[model samples]
Target: MQLSGCIALVTGGGSGLGAATARHFAASGANVAVLDFNAEGANAVADEIGGLALQADVSDEAAVSAAFGKAITHFGSAPRIAVSCAGVGMAARIVGREGKLSFDVFEKTLRVNLFGTYNVMSHAAILMAELDPLADGERGVIINTASVAWQDGQLGQAAYAASKGAIASMCLPAARELAQSGIRVMAIAPGLFHTPMMEGLPEEVTAKITANIPFPARLGEAREFAMLAEQIVENPFLNGTTIRLDGAVRLPTR
Candidate 1:
């Protein structure tokens, strides 16, 4: 899985983890495509890295298709490596002061987090299957972003946790199914990180969350997540599993 000259597609590549991964991939000699709903951010990243920028909402099939088509046209081929980082975070209790969270809220989270990942992974795999297998008959790799909340969801995290849980759960099955095509599927379940997700929260809440991490006693860097993505892409044996990038933190129910 040498990254040099590899065409990589990263959804949500405008900011946070996705952006970091795109930068790292480009630095590692990969021709990157920065796909994001934020057209400005995507273009900025693309310009910085001398790569392609595509705008699309990952949950929209038509948009995803268009984005890929643009990438193919620009790169002269489909991307073989895809990192799905497009997702949203939400907080709503199943039964709370709001008199039960709205169904729309729950469904939205699932749509963007779980369905979005599936959408990109499926498209990426289909495109990869057309590529001639690299060394060891490997066609490509897909890395999905999950969250530690999938395993230990706190209060008000029913919807978010469910979405992330599904993302993690499907990794193995996808890997198993795609193996015959020489494409590997893996997931990353991140703990508290310095992404916009956390930055958008109140300072007090952020502190309380950071206090729980056992080591480093601080927030996880976006680059750390990107590093693991690189490792997963380079290590052929690493497949069909979700790696927790939480710095040994285990989130407790709030």
Candidate 2:
């Protein structure tokens, strides 16, 4: 579906990829809603883009439902585009030192990354199903964020990898199920991007990380990710898959 004149909601819009996407959607003529757990950050981005700001923990079902309701009330319609980017990247080995189990870390990672994406997508699809279809009977599109670590997960990434892996694995089935409702589902698996997570790394450490990437041999820009999201929204046939935005880099085991 075309982005112009559409209503778009982006979770985790307070910073990083989501922030960039919110701005891009607004620039593309879509009425955007910026949702984040960080209320202040959400407000700042929304103010900058002239879009609505919503605060909620994506993993909280009631909070997410309420956020979507508020967005609908403010925009006078449900979002035609919903992007799920709110997630945490906590890492831990399944069996850490001293026989400490990482169950808590695992549970939290899945709750925020996997369950959170599912919550947003479910709500978005429901609302989209009620909307009038656009060209090709398209009602809306949902984009989710996954990580290259899903497949290239290094040591100390069991929790992170499993959460992201579930997202990647859900793409096709979700698209198939939502197809009947004229809603598309897709995911983006980004590799080593220049997000807030990478901000505090030492220069030498950063260099070592980038050395694995081919070609540009640097971190992917947030805008580049936004560009791909736009491309997916405009291309209806690009559903039911996870597109890797990594610079052709397969991560190594640490």
Candidate 3:
């Protein structure tokens, strides 16, 4: 469906890929809602785009539901487009140098990444189903964020990989279930991108990471990701699949 005159909600919209997507949707004439656990960041981005700001922990069902409700109250209805970009990264081997990997870390990642995506998608789909379908009987579209690690997880990526893999693996079932309601579900498995998640690395480490890309040999930009999100929302046939936005790069086990 066209973005113009629609409402779009983006999790983690305060910065990085989420921020770029929020901006892109706003530019396309959609009313945007910037949702993030970081209240200041969310508000800043919302102010810049003339959109609404919502603060909540995506992993919490009640919090996420309330956030959606607030967004609906502010924007007048559920968003036509919902993008799940709220996630965290942790690097730890199943058995670390000290001992076995901490169960708490592993569980935390899964809760935030996999369960969090589920939380938003479920709530968004519920609201979208209540809306009238567009020309092709399309009510809305959901785009989730995955990672290349899901497919080719390197050493020390057990938790991160499993969480992302859950997202990638759910695409087919979610799309099939939502199809009857005229809502499409899709996921994007991004390669390395320049986001705050990577900001803590040294300059040379960052450079080395991008140098591995096959062709572009550079980190993917957030706007590039936003472009694909727009395409997914506008294209009705692209459903029930996870698109890899990586530039043909399969990371080797480190």
Candidate topping lDDT: 2
What global local distance difference test value does model 3 have? Answer: 0.94
Find the candidate with the highest TM-score and give its number: 2
lDDT-based ranking, best first? 2, 3, 1
Candidate 1 residue lDDT tens string, 1-254: 98899999999999999999999999999999999999999999999999999999999988898888899999999998999998888787787685865678799999998888899998899999999998699999999999999999988888999999999999999999999999999999999999987898898998888899899999999999999999999999999999998879987768
**Candidate 3: worst-modelled 10 consecutive residues by lDDT:** 93-102
| Local accuracy of candidate 2 as per-residue lDDT tens digits, 16-126 | 999999999999999999999999999999999999999999999999999999999999999999999999999888898999998999999999999999999999999
Candidate with the larger TM-score of 1 and 3 = 3
lDDT pick, better of 2 and 3:
2
What is candidate 1's local distance difference test score?
Answer: 0.93
Better of 1 and 3 by lDDT: 3
Off-target runs (Cα >4 Å) in candidate 3 are none
Clashes of 3: 0
Clash pairs for candidate 1: none
